[model samples]
Target: MGQVRDQRGDHIRDQSDDQSPDESTRKETSMQDSILQEGINEVIGTTHLNAAPMGIILRGGRHTLALFKRSHTAANIVGDGWFVANLIHDPVIYVESAFGDLPDDAFTTEIIDGTPMHRLAAAEAWVAFRAEVIGESSEAYSILLTPIKEEVLVRSIRPVNRGFNAIIEAAVHATRYIMNHDPELEWLIRHHLALARKCGGEREKEAAGMVERFIGEDSL
Candidate 1:
């Protein structure tokens, strides 16, 4: 993986508003075309994507648990031209949003300027979902979305600190959703759980409990 270049810099990419009329139209057309996938190569999607922060932690709100809640926002230029889905979540949360079916087609693996971003296509979107069991019945909702223009990496990662237990509680929480849905990520998920186990014993029981509740033996 390539280094972040320099950690002291505040690298932000907010292209939604800066594009020229023609350039923006072209990009939009390209993204829409890519999504159709008549013959885009799978390997083209892997470019510069090997080194990206896999998951992120989110701070949720009260409506997060309540109905009409909105924590995460998915904004997009739809076939009709615009779409928005305001979604909510837990107080301290983990979210696996920017990914979708046909992974390669979902994001553009381009490093525009210095930031790596995927020009999410029509079928590709940003969404946030959460559910809770209400006795015998469980209610769930999803927030369909568009990619964000900017975000900060909480901490730059390196081989030295990217160990199993190195994941924060929020990382575990966010990852649970992805790990559960994608069987291919089983090994990566187990590695995080094993790290949680290592941080076990009474001292780390709270953390361990998090693992159990989310991805432990019974949960898995």
Candidate 2:
């Protein structure tokens, strides 16, 4: 039931004592995402979600990093012992791009359950992402991530609160999700993607497939 607010008064995760990035890093990240969003719109013709914002989800133990299939990225990036998650706040999604290289604009603003969420950029995050992924830091890939219903195979969709590890039901946190299906989330998803092309959780699940494949068994 603990909730925190951003400057815009959006309910994000509770503020932790961890040291936050400096102001310069924050501003630069915003600039990057804005520019990226523009490019995405132009390429996709104003409808940005034709492809969900792709992200790298970091995980521990048996699994490693994750991304959407259309992203055209490899799973080997997990070798980069570090992790940089992207937090998105839109009507439907609330994902965290666990790796820095995944792309921005995935972390911008949108109305969700009547609240607004702004963008969160990753500057030093990119540096960290490259170091670990290219560094070949570990065979299993040592990085940080969280747990949720989607786990790591969300692909293209951005994450919510990077610090908030799970997709909590509205009653659990006064946000979204109730009885496993969120009406607002459903509507928002429909808004982003055209149902004609591919639709619904069944399709998303089918697209996501097995997390282990993304983890590295099939090896991208």
Candidate 3:
């Protein structure tokens, strides 16, 4: 087996020769797909288990997150050098975590590669990784997460719902709008809210309401 250094100059094994036929086929299929996948994810870091909804970018073989400067996620990852990215399908989780901390019941502790880490109890999948800050700007820290352990906790088939997707989109914009109070972001939030109301189920409608409440209805 060969070895390569990551952005942090840490030696990482090249697993190309160790893969079985199934794993090799999966790798080929993944490479054929779009290299970038963006989604809202729950990130848990710090010993206190600080949780937040953040945008996760999966490009090539690395998972990356752009942590806003001064945010708890940035501070925790910098201090501890590790965190977990959780795949959460619930819009309520996104809206609540985006605004503030989630309740204690929302989290559960599990050992990943012999290290205890906090993860979302409702996560469909979770990846525990070491954070290597590859770059930084005045606004945010660019981090490359090297996965040490990953697991899919649940697998279920569900049809796509536009309303649910709209809620996710609104929550993403709302997270930024609350910080800058940008009028354009506010419009996007309301636009998604409308779609959620028109097409979503009760849960989507409730989640949209939470977003509106957090962003303040007076401005709308």
Candidate 4:
């Protein structure tokens, strides 16, 4: 009886070991599927009419040109050609506004052209632009805009490092602007900076540190 029980236990253990790889693979696949499905659902659920499209021109070095077209959707920008989308909550009028008619061969016209990833890139670009703008602003405006700016910054830092840099740069610019205009807002900016440093991941934390250093020592 003892021998039979031991053999049964060994057999059960062997079965479990054999199934482990398959189980793990299934779990991984399921997770990936969930993520993909969630992304699809988000795109579907989003309302596109409220947001505006921005022409994303990617220029490499001096001559390489990649033009990506995207539109603001649900506080982010969705590119027509990529998988990841950009999260630009407060888009500038200049970026969002159309100056001239779109080109005849513009990618925005077709739904099947760009991927969700391209949209994500556009969003990141917008964030970077915002960061640069904000980093040059006055202290008072930074204070007034802190809540919105910080919200955008947090979102920007989550997915891509480039996006994180954009948000940080923008925040730094805004801080500098505020310090130049209203020195009193520096204290508030510092407080917010501390909060941002504590909230994000490693990259975000690094960004927060950079922002704090830039703003803290900024001459303006």
Candidate 5:
């Protein structure tokens, strides 16, 4: 009787171990599906408000709407860099607005410049900015869409930080391509440099530098 009980226990343990990965994988897939659906809903449901000429849109209510518009515009043009930058910068504005004070004029002015450097800087600064904003603001993070296994996989809805990171990654690749062959836009290069400074993190800074080096002054 003892031997039979031991054999049954071993069998159950083996089955449980075998089932774990399958269960985990199913849960992950379901979560991914939900995320992907949310992204589609956002893109489809919202009206595209043009803060600028780009195809970006501003979502949310009137108060922070302009900021969202501007941030989206940057993201559309530059990708993740803008998202990251905005995540950092939004809190600065929030703090100023809360205290009935204004943010540094320089910071606001630089954001309008919309150069690559400025964009990069915005992305860098956004890392810290996002944390503060999340702490203070009720705004929720956005979900990300990625291609996986013949369907769009959606990851966790990140607030501005993750959204910005996503945009930065895309922008970096695009910037690299543009820098390697097309170099007439000196202004664009400067803009990217400004963006690099905003990135604040070492990896982002390095990526921005790589883009800058690729488009040398001589080439431009």
Candidate 6:
């Protein structure tokens, strides 16, 4: 057994890296089958129990995370060696989490392989993975995560909603614009906001309003 400290300097028990060779192979196969699409999803980490939107990539049939070096998600995963990847479709979740730490009520915990892990309460599905930081650079770290456990929480089938899609795009741009102050990103945010207002449902409209408040662009 081993232990690591989160960003808050609190000790957390590390999940053992030891795995039977056959067990490792089986888990890898499962990861390739389910995580076929590479896209953005909310990642919940134990460091302050924070949730952040991150991109999950499928490279050579293995799931990988290229995390920013300065992010709380990176710090938490580096220290804990494990985290949960949430498949969520709500624009509210994406917008709220992109801006700041979500309220405590938004999360729930489960014990996976004896280690308690945090996950989004509204995730459509969830996967538990053990991560290894395989590469690093000045700006970010490349991580390889293998699925150890997974479950589907919601099974609803719905048609594609462009309004929801627009809100997601807006949320992504809003987060980047806050950090870099790039004028292009702001323009993109407004463009997406317009799409949301024109095409999105009530929830999407609400999300667009949140994005406006988030970036101090009430003029939208």
Stretches off by above 4 angstroms in model 5 are 1-186, 217-220
Taking all chains together, the TM-score of candidate 1 against the true structure is 0.26
List, residue by residue over 51-94, the lDDT tens digit for candidate 4: 22222222221101111112232123222211221344321321
Write the residue-wise lDDT of candidate 1 on 1-220 in tens digits. 1111110111222222332334453344222211111221111111112111221112221111111111111111111122211221211111122121224553443343344444333212232222121111122222211222222213334233233233443343334344345554555555665664564444233443443344443333
**C-alpha RMSD of candidate 4:** 23.0
TM-score, candidate number 5: 0.25
Least well predicted 10-residue stretch by lDDT in candidate 6? 1-10
Note the clash tally of each candidate: 4, 14, 0, 33, 30, 0
The 10 consecutive residues of candidate 1 with the worst lDDT sum are 1-10
Candidates in order: C-alpha RMSD to true structure: 17.5, 17.5, 10.1, 23.0, 22.3, 7.7
Q: Which digits, one per residue and each the tens of the lDDT, describe model 6 over residues 1-220?
A: 0111111111222222333335556554345455336553334333337887765665455666776767777877888888677887787877777766788878888887788888888888888787776666666677767777788889889789889989978876776676567889989999999999999988899999988887785223
Model 6 stretches astray by more than 4 angstroms = 1-32, 35-48, 217-220
Q: Name the lDDT value of residue 47 in candidate 3.
A: 27
The numbered model that scores best in TM-score is: 6
Where's the lowest-lDDT run of ten residues in candidate 2?
38-47
Off by over 4 Å in 4: 1-85, 88-181
Model 6 alpha-carbon miss at residue 66, Å? 1.0
Q: Residue 168: error of model 3 in Å? A: 1.1
Q: Which candidate should be chosen as best, given lDDT against the real structure?
A: 6
User: Of the candidates numbered 3 and 4, which has the greater lDDT value?
Assistant: 3
Q: All models: lDDT?
A: 0.27, 0.24, 0.65, 0.26, 0.26, 0.69
After TM-score superposition, what is the CA distance of residue 159 in candidate 2 from its true location, in Å?
Answer: 23
Tens digits of lDDT, candidate 2, 63-115: 12332212222232233122223333332232212111224464433332243
Point out the worst 10-residue segment of candidate 5 by lDDT: 1-10
